[model samples]
Target: MCPPEHFTVEYAINPWMDTKIAVDGALALKQWASLRDTLTDLGHLVHVLDARPGLPDMVYSANGAFSVDGTVYGARFKYPQRAGEADEHRAFYAEKTDNWRFFAPEQVNEGEGDFTYLPGAYGGIVLAGYGFRTDPAAHAEAQEILGRPVISLKLVDPAFYHLDTALAVLDDRHVTYYPEAFSPASQRVLAQLFPDALLADRSDAEAFGLNLVSDGRHVILNTEATAMGHKVRAAGYLPVHVNLSELKLGGGSVKCAVAELRP
Candidate 1:
């Protein structure tokens, strides 16, 4: 059978969010609205995962899981509270598609948050970032399961819990990231791979909502990231920013909201 078509989206549900992880609920909801509006404007097919009772904190889905090829793989978060989330996603994927898998119950891995794909980078190599929610052992498992090389990198900051939070590669040569979020080795690797990358300074990165989506030339970001927004525009890209401060409380932005379906 052929693999199913792919598309990315974010869910609006919250309350499942850990209070420790999210400082304020009211602010996060506002951010979610901004992110939602932006995705809708961009012609993305936003699929809203049904809200589960007692799972009020479900808005942190950027860490939930992601799809690779035709198979759906759920992430194993380092946080114990999030372990049950994998089961929830497994059920969601099973209902949506037949191809479903996990990172071995014992292994740990968060999907899009820690994992990303760059089609032009080494025949579409998949880079899985570790040192945050995803464990190193899980990265190896992902490599074996996906049948592609999964490069691992350690994220340097706690605030940037996942790779996507601090760095997102928009295309093969261009990347959106905050340099402070990367370790020395990871920085070097990033430099070697994306020689023409657009690295944003801390203030601009935070203001621009750095980890957003890019369909090659068009980048979707938060309007709040003004400086970064201007830089992206200068780089010959159409930068679309929506307000997603509410969603930020759940610890993700536009990148976490939408999944991309590749041909």
Candidate 2:
């Protein structure tokens, strides 16, 4: 994870970003530190990425890369603002680790922001979101590279630009998402894939409740998602709340701040 050392809404790419509202740099750092500490306390190993000078959005490390079966798929950012981040991530993985293969995508794909793994009885099933930051063609390329079935889901809402912002995969049988963020066909696809998944209410979804990180038993989410927390607990998972309001100014929260290394 990279700290928000250079984080700021200098320009607006997503609907959530407003250059007029100044981000609290100090508060963002504090919140990011707390999140890192919380993950460490939860028995997860945390890896820090060096924050580059000009890449402000580098703090949202989930968009950096996607790893599966020891192979790292580097991001090809759609926007020029985040274009430099792809190379930095590739270099980090190339230099910092061994026993990993790297594959830079030929098409534009925002790493985990659009590609999420779904755990199930099958060996591997990936949910690929597109029609926003990610190109739909990249779905096939990702599937070929990873050798997994890729389910393409289309995003319809500007507020929920990335799949990570609109949905959270909670183990094999369940997921949490905002139905309206997806196109009607994608909504049907979700219903078919996860018949019993928890659907987030408008209030919770607007609070970025689906922008969460789960470790099978525990879920880390925004403190503002009070109602969503109750639902998570009801579904048999511990809800850990963290105030990432300052980071939200830059259009991210708990999940965005993390990048999982899948084996």
Candidate 3:
């Protein structure tokens, strides 16, 4: 997780971003600190990636790269506004990590923003989202790098621009997502893959409910996802809440700020 040092909504890349509505930098910092602390309290190591200037969306660190085992598939952003962030991620990995193989992607992919790895689901599979921020060709590239079957799920809703905005992999076996955010074929694919999936209603989804992270049992929900909290509890996962109303202005929540680095 990177600190929201330079976090702001200067550009309107996504629907949630509005340059007119000014961001509370101090509040965003507090929210980021809380998220880091909360995850720390949950026994998760929160790695801090230094934030760079001119990249407000750097706060959404999950888009940096995708790592599993010892292999890292570095991100190649679609939009030029976020293009610099990819190199920042690559540089960080080269400087910080040990013995991890890194691959600079040729295809356009937004790392964890589009690729979600379920280490234990279907004996391990990557549910890759496309037709939005990520390119479908990137799925094959990722599958080769990670040595896992990459399932292409197409995103339709502009609001749910990234896959993380519409889906949360709660654990190896469980997931919760907004069905409408995906295309009909994609929705059917998900239903076939996760038959017992927890479906989030439009209201909860619009509240940024699906943008979450889970340590299998504990799911950290964003602000105003009240219905999501109830749904997760009903599905037997503990709902840990956080107030990221300020961060939500930039269209990201817990999952976006936190990148999963699997060993």
Write down the TM-score of every candidate: 0.82, 0.97, 0.98
Comparing 1 with 3 on lDDT, the higher-scoring candidate is 3
Count clashing pairs, candidate 2: 0
Writing each residue's lDDT as its tens digit, candidate 2 over 1-263 gives 99999999998888889999999999999999999998999999998998888899999999988888877888999999999999988987888577678899889999999988875725668898998899999999888888889899999988899999889988765788989999999999998888888889778877989989999898999899899899999999999999999888888889989998886
Candidate number of the best lDDT: 3
Query: What's the CA RMSD for each of the models?
Result: 6.1, 1.1, 1.0
Candidate 2 residue runs with Cα over 4 Å from true position: none
The digit string of per-residue lDDT tens for model 3 on 1-92 reads 88999988888889988999999999999989999999999999887888999998999999999988878999999989999999988987
lDDT of 3: 0.91
Q: What's the residue-level lDDT of 15 in candidate 1? A: 26
Quote the positional error of residue 96 for candidate 3 in Å: 4.0
Instruction: Please report, as a residue range, the 10-residue window in candidate 1 with the lowest summed lDDT.
Output: 1-10
In candidate 2, where is summed lDDT lowest over 10 consecutive residues? 115-124
**Model 2 residue 176 lDDT?**
86
Which pairs clash in the backbone of model 2?
Answer: none
